[model samples]
Target: MADMQKALRARILGAGIVPRVIWGRKVPQGTALPYLQLFAVSDPRPGHLKGYNGGRTTRVQADCKAESYAEAKAMSDALVPLLAAPATVDGIKFGHTKAEGPQDLGEDTAAGFVHRMSLDLLVWHSSV
Candidate 1:
């Protein structure tokens, strides 16, 4: 099966909506504001019954981080509809994404107290 997490990361970055979308939680030093951190909360094969992807459900946490709360929230606001739209990538046919956030995670003081808006996504997809 195609790697859904990688595909989602590529798609988001390719959208050019944000300056950067890192594949993991940890951001590198000296990165700019209004960036994204992508994390896979879970990736489970829901069933063996056949289709494009075998009915996989990918739970992901996509956090928008910035120097201020508004910037973080704005970045995430721009992403919600895009992620929720239906599409296909790298043999992974995506269905609508169910999101549970833009939840304020306050700030990460360790990371310069960057304000974070977190988007938890439940994605339905299949790898054809």
Candidate 2:
């Protein structure tokens, strides 16, 4: 749901690592450095056929951008732990979140060096 995504964004922002966080796409033009870009790639509902009630698995991507690779990796390091733990955000009870790849993207002419990480979250809510 949209609320889940918003909550996730809020959680990322609350970490206080990056100053800017944008969803659905990359940072906007004229945005400052040391920003984060979040994307909700997929949400597969009814995670399991046996328990086809109120659970879903979402694949999310968090891209950390900075002037240098070290900064980018540091930001990502902070983020990985936050996402890995189970937490409740905006009424959505998120279970364990598994992450993969601080895949080095090397550099970007516009966005600077990038480190992209993928997170798979198991989320569930009673009213869903």
TM-scores of the models, in the order given = 0.84, 0.80
lDDT (CA) for every model shown? 0.81, 0.70
Question: lDDT by residue for model 2 over 16-128, one digit each (tens)?
Answer: 98787788774577876678777778777764657666757777777777777788888888887787777777777777677777787656565444444333333333333
Model 2: lDDT of residue 36: 79
Tell me the spans in candidate 1 whose CA falls farther than 4 Å from its real position: 48-53, 108-111
Prediction RMSDs, each to the true structure: 2.6, 3.1
Worst 10 residues of 2 by lDDT: 119-128
In model 2, the runs with Cα more than 4 Å from the true position are 47-52, 110-128
lDDT of 1 at 105: 92
lDDT of residue 112 for candidate 1: 70
